[model samples]
Target: MSLDYEEFNALFTQFERTAIHLEMRDSYGTAIELPHMAKWATGEPDDLAWLQDWCDLVREGTQAGKSFRRAHVIGEPLSDYQRWSHSIMQPHIDAGSEVRWVPRRLVSSIAFPGNDFWLFDDRLVVFHNYAGNGQIIDFVTSTEPADLRLCKAAFDAVWPLGIPHEQYKLD
Candidate 1:
């Protein structure tokens, strides 16, 4: 079933220990993230008002003994949006979320999911469906053992190979 934002947040926030996200796209064209992204493309710094909610949540989650991790599988010659996204993720990292960059070609042996996902406590999985322009289409959560297995394997196969956000050189 598809979950609205409130329901999704409620479910995710309930994770007892770890929440892991796997992001495979090179660029996300979300409207709210565009302005700052645009400024970043031009080498001009822009204040990000849009990420406040997420920032707050990461902060709170980390404060309460939860581990928040995100792994980005990016190609060589990073996209403009990826560069911008990396710059913005520092605050999330500072808030104790572990953000890592996995160069895409390195994980060819593993079969990856078609969409991005959030895996909570190694049990539940939430897959994110996004339109071509990056508008969210829906979020589907599943606890099926097969899904958990695949997601967990894909994530584990990539996480250690990824460079931590602080060490990833800006392209």
Candidate 2:
């Protein structure tokens, strides 16, 4: 099923055990992030106040014994968007979710699904479909055993190769 924003938001807290996200894009045009990215491009400072809601959610989840982890399969010489994303990740890290970076070059042999996804408790997969320019097209959810297995295995293959956010530095 295609999920609206509210439904997608609910999945974060709805999952029972783990919420793991796999991000494959080098850039994204999320509306909320454009303004922040622009501010970053001009070298302006942002207090990142807008991220508080997500931070709170992650904090709450972690305290409840749930795990939130994300793996970004990023390209080398990070794009402007990725660089800015990396800079803003500290707050999320502090809030409780663990962020890791995996260089794209290192994962050429692994078979990944066609889109980005969040695998929840190894049961449901929420696929994030984006247009070529990185604008979100829609959010799709799937629970088929094959789909779940692909997502789980893909994430597993990539996770071990990730460099924790603290140790991943831009060149």
Candidate 3:
């Protein structure tokens, strides 16, 4: 039904070992990150060299066949950080990996109905309440194909409508 923070962490670590399909969506902010995600994605370090090494390891993991997919639908177009972060995945995309961009409205209409957003990793679903005090208040289901397919369909529909990166500059 639900797991505390330690349990959730262990489960995710296990998921990493098994190489399951991991999918997530989030709004842009510094406070909302899991400590590891924050450190890996946008962390400052005491030593620049160590930070670069960590970044290299992340890049290696990403290249070594991690099926990670994410979508961001901001109120407006992406901010500079969003753009940069999304751009960082270009090499993976070029290598024929599964990364995507879905319009936020379509995602809102489908997966995240009413309030809170959903994170679907194979079957483990985390429903986060955005309207609340910014905590991940619920862990709903695990690896439901029907629900995942529905969300994917919504993403597919919106993805085609997204302007390509080259065209983004023109906008």
> Which prediction has the highest TM-score against the true structure?
2
Q: Candidate 2: minimum summed lDDT over ten consecutive residues — where?
A: 4-13
Superposed Cα RMSD, model 1: 1.5
Q: Which residue pairs clash in candidate 2?
A: none
lDDT by residue (30-147, candidate 2, tens digit) is 9989999999999999999999999999999999999999999999989999999999999999999999999999999998999999999998999999999888989999999999
Candidate achieving higher lDDT, 2 or 3: 2
Candidate 1, residues 9-126, lDDT tens digits: the string is 8865699999999999998876677777778878896766677778888888889999999999999889877877888888788778999999988988878888899999998999
Please give the lDDT score at residue 113 for candidate 2. Answer: 94
lDDT, candidate 1, equals 0.88
Q: In candidate 1, which residue ranges exceed 4 Å CA deviation?
A: none
lDDT of 3 at 39: 52
* Least accurate 10 contiguous residues by lDDT in model 1: 45-54
Instruction: Quantify all predictions' global Cα lDDT against the true fold.
Output: 0.88, 0.96, 0.44
Instruction: Kindly state the number of residue pairs that clash in model 1.
Output: 0
Model 1 Cα shift for residue 93 (angstroms) = 0.8
| Clash pairs for candidate 1 | none
